[model samples]
Target: MSGVREPAGAYDPVDALLQRAHRLGADPRNTNYAGGNASAKGTATDPVTGGDVELMWVKGSGGDLGTLTAAGLAVLRLDRLRALAGTYPGVDREDEMVAAFDHCLHGKGWLPGGEGTAPSIDTAMHGLVGAPHVDHLHPDSGIALACAADGEELTRRCFGERVVWVPWRRPGFQLGLDIAAVYEAHPGAIGVVLGGHGITAWGKDSAECERNSLEIIRTAERFLAEQGRPDPFGPLVEGYGPLPAPERRERAAALAPVIRGLASADRPQVGHFTDADAVLDFLAREAHPRLAALGTSCPDHFLRTKVRPLVLDLPPDAPLDEAVARLRELHAAYREDYRAYYERHADAGSPPMRGADPAIVLVPGVGMFSFGKDKQTARVAGEFYVNAVNVMRGAEAVSSYAPIPEAEKFRIEYWELEEAKLRRMPPPKPLATRVALVTGAGSGIGRAIARRLVAEGACVVVADRDADAAEAVAAGLGGPDRALAAVVDVTDEEQIAAAFRAAVRAFGGVDLVVNNAGISVSKPLAETTAADWDTQHAIMARGSFLVSREAARVLAAQGMGGDIVYIASKNGVFAGPNNIAYGAAKADQAHQVRLLAAELGGLGVRVNGVNPDGVVRGSGIFAGGWGAQRAAVYGVPEEKLGEFYAQRTLLKREVLPEHVANAVFALTAGELSHTTGLHIPVDAGVAAAFLR
Candidate 1:
């Protein structure tokens, strides 16, 4: 009820406001990373005169409040802000309103060297509230009430006389004016609920403002608790037998690629699947389809979650192949329905709308999937939709789910201000959104390939028989989101299968597979044992076959074109003394590449191979003590092995692992888009191994 008295120590109002902003923004239940804002009014020494002047410090637009700094707060004079608010008779365009706010910035009030950052759109409202501190947030509890069918009545009942209620209005000059008018009418109110938007609370200081806001949210939470709704997803918990644990995870993994492919038809996207309790509960509800159609709880959510999610019903026992086909059909229908909705609602003067595609996909019996340009954003979008499910359920439990009107959705979704935010993003890399799996990627040529793929913006899976080595390489390339580690023995079928499953779980699916795992035995034909021959072929020949088979299955199911690459050796094409086992197995691997290319070409899968000669440096095979033995067979000093091979090539340069990786990149980078069933030699121009 009273303002928080200044603390006994040295006090800085700006620092105090920033501290509260970070606290509110850190709690997703209170406000998401960039969703909420805070402001404080204080006195500062006038630059022109020796008198004190009033200044308002509001969170700047487009900065994350959780990481707010002094520079992130835009400073403006209170008198100028009020004057700008008085000029807005009813409504104005986004640019015009921004221009007015920019004009009100005090010349010397900003933090030293802090200029150009625009104040939040709520600046005028904060100025008009006549409070020393103001906080605006889209708290889940407050939004649950704001979106209820009987929102106004519920507000009155929940908060009694402590809060005022304002009807939904687009956030800008007009909304600020309405908030000010409502505040004047209810001078005793400490907080105001913006119907279909969020809530705002004001007080004499940062502590009082945050306290009042939390009190309002607490009231809403209590009201929802009393409604007494049982959890709908208790049956889908970990030990449930309806859909066995392994089968549920497998089905979700299979469905992910299909969902990602549909959502990213025009462009590439990454998908994140969530089986959180709230999501599963929403899916299990009987009125889910109708409830999900009601749209997002707030207008700000429209930018990320979209107006509605695409819902699919896949029975637990349904075959994945059939489910994939059904998903494609349903996705087409969703797009058509979205187009119809736009046509029915577009004003006569509006421009042609962008394609209507869903950002979140809801699949019953599996999970919910969200798509974005990358993993972080996909996860964020999914989190927002999960929160939406909670808010919608809370509202429905008390009464009916009432979202903002469709016209409002259109305005916010197509607004130039919102469109500009997306357009400002940097252009994506060539391999952005694509996922790659590199076998034996713990070191040498395989690790080089993984690093190259990640540098090109591809999410990479580093697979090797050494768990620690694989994890080290993956961590070096990028963290868990962009790079995953899998300890897999290429000779084992089960390990290979599990590795691919892990890849699909980490990223939505794999767009490229580099079968680089291999071994070598440099024994003469007469001295080669059956065990040595089997070991060589098991990795180079059989391993490539199995990895390619799994890659084909996943890529074909996605209905998107992909690439498969094999790391062959020049010995396969050029016979070398005492290279019986190694040469024979690599030859088999190269031929398999051709056969797969012929078979998978119709499915939009490209198969290729790279043959490099004597890459002694940074080669795991050479580093494993093979270099000394190979040098002895060649009658050269161990240190001169690289020089011997370099002199043999026409180009006279020593081959390196990175040189092989570049050839692999060329095949997957779309430069050789039309060329498949080809083997590229990366041996610094080895004349004998050249394809003729």
Candidate 2:
């Protein structure tokens, strides 16, 4: 079939620019979530004259290029941007340039919602260029050349006279002018390499711009290949190596809690491990100590990876306790050194900088660890450093790895424009740093409890036997960053262990676990089959036991106090007909809570239980046609069953899953800090089930 043809005059420059931005931004080797920017020149008909008017479409400040949209591209008058360049003097002119760009917006910089969007910091340079399309990216391959000691000479040899080379200048009005002048001198150049920064390419269209950028990167890769030196990590590709020994892995797991404790301040932090061959190779190098101390391959990574990673000297024979003590001492020293570096570079004009704590940590026998407020941020930082390892290795393969000088590094790290991006975020929630796991979270009380926990700012693991249901619940709570779905049969010991491991891999470690998974079978004592009894006991009794056991192990190893809550039924305490099997299993679970509380209290772990009754709405147990069947046994309509239970309660109100969730939160949130092994009745005042 022939392609459908569009009407004449249908070319869209904004769409073209967005497509290219996403293409480049999606590549981790090129740009991370918000690393790069792009711009394009286009024309629109003037409302009054019906004449073509030039417009500049630049990527908005603080927006992700991977998901660029028309709203994310700030439209400005080309003439205004060019004119704004003359308003700023040469030195420290970023603020003035920003103001001018803000004023140059199409209609007082107003967007659809009446708020204005700021253009990229490179808007001035993009406007000055003659080409219709322009892109600025921080590709690792190209950065390998830009950060090398002989970068300029190598770039010249690689591109010949096809590209311009601009010396390092902190990005602002002055740099834009410098870029324009360099381009003017080499009018035929396809792109320019900004020494110690990144690369910028331009063309008449988006495709041409992207093609030129990739070609420049490919050229750098070929030039490095011609150098004939072995990979810096030897034969290793990107510094990966074989996994560490089993004993070493165990030690790393044991040491994670100690590292997390040392790194935390007012709030706790999470720690994630990486045994990727690239990371292992970097740690194994003889010059690892000296090479690792050097600054990051690019300035954009300074905020996430820090100027330098912390290197711990851990001996193979040292005990875990001694390792913890040594780490504590070294962490204190690391902060002191960071303060010294700041003092050496601080100016009277700039605001006081926060102490530089280590984001990446290297342990020789254990591999690498990255720390963050939560798992997602930790993973992003880790990925960047992993790329940094490759870039440094690439540079060393061609020549010695030489980063920008300390003064420039300080300037970039402390730049107010870059720092503003972080300041724009709202304050974190109270439970923001905590991670939780809720079993049976695909529906009912478990799902309600998981939602409440996340709303209060905890990362959650939604575990259930139903994988699709669990995934749906996780998606509803938020994306994978906030909640992970784990298919787990809690009665299976191996599956329970694997779920905890997956939780740790997803979000560092777990601080709270809610054992809310259970099954119910209604039948007279004599009529109940052996299979029916075993099924209820398998989930309600044995499953709760296994989950609690695993939780204690992880919480104790973390060296931090945590909460484990079991969801028992009111029938556990108050005997009821036709509920013998379920009631017995729940009674076992309730007693297990008390025993666990007694044993784990010494390890700083808390164990508790919530006994809920008649919460039929949105409950999986009541669904699948079981509600009608159970209601018939009680001689009440299914619709009236909830009211029937409510009338029997002292409070005369229907109990809800949310009420049970609130009780769970109360016990786990430290409101009842001094209490443990306690069961809070959540049946809207069912006095029969009250603690005697």
- Listed per model in order, the count of residue pairs whose N, CA or C atoms clash below 3 Å is 0, 5
- Write model 1 residue lDDT over 525-618, tens digit each, in one string: 8999999999999988998998888888889877788999999989889989999999999999889889999999998999999999998999
Q: Which runs of model 1 end up more than 4 angstroms from their true locations? A: 1-9, 40-59, 67-82, 92-95, 100-129, 182-187, 227-242, 319-322, 347-352, 635-644, 647-652
Clash pairs of candidate 1?
Answer: none
Number of the top-ranking candidate, with lDDT as the measure: 1
TM-score, one value per model: 0.89, 0.87
| lDDT against true structure, model 2 | 0.79
The C-alpha local distance difference test score for the whole of candidate 1 amounts to 0.82
Shift in Å, residue 476, candidate 1: 3.4
Worst 10 residues of 1 by lDDT: 232-241
Q: For model 2, how does the per-residue alpha-carbon lDDT over 1-692 read when each residue is reduced to its tens digit? A: 00112246655677778788988888776676677689888776554576766778888887778888777777788887888666767665565677678777776432445444677677877888878888888777677777778888878987898877787877777777787787778778888888877788888888899898778777777877787377564543222233347765666666665666556643577667777777777776665677788968577666678788888765444677887777878888888888888888878865567545688887765667787777777777787788778778777877677877777878877777766766877887757778899999999999999999999888899999999999999999988778999999988998888788777756667889999997788888998899988998998898998898888877876777889999987888998878788889999999998999999999888889999987888888887565776798789999888888899899899888899999988887766888899988999888878888
> Candidate 1 clash total?
0
